[model samples]
Target: MSLVVTPLELPERWDEPGPRGDAFRAFHAHAERSNAMRFGPDVVARSPEERLASLQPSLAEACRAFVAHRDGQLVGALKVYTPLLESTDVAEIVISAEPDLPDAEVLDLVEELTTHGEQVAAGLGRGDFRGGSLAAASGAVTAATGFGGVDPDHPEVAPLVARGYVLEQVYRISMVDLAALPDLDERLAAARAGAPGYDVVAWAGETPAPHRAGMCRLKEQMAADAPGGGVLFEPEVWDDARLADFEASAASGGRTIRTVAAVEGATGELVGFTSAFVGTSTVVNQQDTVVAGAHRGHGLGALMKLANLAELREHHPNHTRVVTWNAEENRPMLAVNEATGFVTVVHDGVWKRRSVS
Candidate 1:
């Protein structure tokens, strides 16, 4: 059967009630289970509404989704999003085929969706694409050499690799139990003592003006500072307006972000910081954590993380656990997380495609 792909009518069908809505929900559910089959049970597919929430346009990116059907039955999907924070010539794309689709057909669907994603990005005046990706959890390839040979068994992996994409990083999803934490006070005390001449402070909802400037500085440095795993993150262009938009959009999505920042007592400049955000949902996401280059090696990373966790314990008391993802090669940051009782729970692949012209 020949498959047809077109822009999905999200605004109309998203909140629509009835059989059509049921079909819409069923379409995504099938795609999710299908993708999970490739990765494993750890995929933990997000609910349709949660996926919609992720698609909400941000200050730096715009999103679009498409449905692929053959004879009117959903067969696959394409998600295209471009990031202004990254280079103007780059976009992120994800394509999925129904789990039951034959391997050969999966390749065709991926190629078609990729071409569609490229067209979408080109329409935005962008070219190259840098998409975060996933693959089967084992030894299909090594990190430094890009994607190696593909097992004919896993044809779904070929499209991106065949399109000039490379595996830049491996991120492992990790979680820590708040209820079984080793000891809050002892760790917090040690963190404070380890980093002298700095004070740790916490915030919720919005960043206050005094700390806003410093916090923005650390945030702006985020992409460049972290280990890129051979991929350029393309430093985000940050400003007061951009930060405001981020906080507002997040709150509108039912998320509440809590942050803990370490301030230099003498200069009052933010030296390091960590943030955790939770929605009406149970899981609390441990967000960006960074220490100014000048402030590293003082155990501040641990300090801010512990301080933030302590704050969450008080505020989001009912939250069961905290989750985060870190590059597999980032030993320092990963060390801090593990020291705080975080353990690797899942693995993911990060891939990117460069422009030919």
Candidate 2:
């Protein structure tokens, strides 16, 4: 049977009251499930209603969806977001009828989207389509189109390499598993015994305000620690107001953001930190985990992680899994994961394609 792909009608179909709503909801549910299995539970814990509502505006304005139909049955779909951003060309989310579909079909779908993306960019007078997190199967399209690999340590890129995509840069995805929470008292006692004169604290919502400045400094430090000289894509700086906004976003999505910080007793300087959030639907996602350069050898990373894990176990006991990612080459962060018992699950790759005109 022949396959046909076409653009999805927006607001009209998306906001409608009946069959369209059912289809849209089903599609989003499918997308969420795929994301959970492919990217892990932390990344996607939204209900179909929540996802559709959150994505409606973007999908209505700058987003496009392509549906692949084989024998009149919808087999695959891809959603691309084209916000007028500085660095990324397109942000994408995908779902497929055949989760284990052959690599060739996945490549074909990606190529088709790339072609569509190029035309969209040209129409807007932009000359490139910069995308990230190309799955293993889709890496073929990315490679074929000259999308340079970036961040080899990126959690998604290894599978792409196995399928022949080139390695570019290494970025780490740091994670902790709630299922394996260690004894907090023993972990903290060990860290304090080893480091001496260091204290750790957990904060959220308004409580994070006191440490906003310290967190912002850590945010700036991230660029230096990032492999490939990581770029801060968002405009908002890490400050009290921004932290509040993040907390709000998490709360609205039914998630809790827990930020843990390690501070020196004498100097009161922030040395290490980690953030974890539990979704309303019972998934825990780790955000950023960092330790200042001066305090590296003291095992503060593991301490901060253990503190966060303890808080999650006590406060959000319903959470089933704790999910996070790190660049493949980030040994230090990976060391913390090893100490905390986070097993490697999924590997993904980042791909880029520039316009040839």
RMSD of each: 3.4, 5.9
Q: How would you encode candidate 2's per-residue C-alpha lDDT over 136-224 as one tens digit per residue? A: 32233333323223443333343333334333433334345565554666876786688777998887644455567887678656645
**Collision pairs in model 1:** none
Give TM-scores for every candidate, taking all chains together and pairing residue i with residue i: 0.85, 0.74
lDDT of 1 by residue, 227-260 (tens): 7766666777678888898787766545788988
Please give the TM-score that candidate 2 achieves against the real structure. 0.74
Task: Locate the minimum summed-lDDT window of 10 residues in model 1.
Answer: 144-153
Runs off by more than 4 Å, candidate 1: 12-14, 18-50, 96-108, 135-140, 145-153
Once superposed on the true structure, which residue ranges of model 2 sit more than 4 Å away at CA? 1-16, 36-45, 53-67, 81-97, 100-103, 121-184, 229-241
Question: Judged by TM-score, which candidate is best?
Answer: 1
Backbone steric clashes in candidate 2, count = 20
lDDT of 2: 0.59
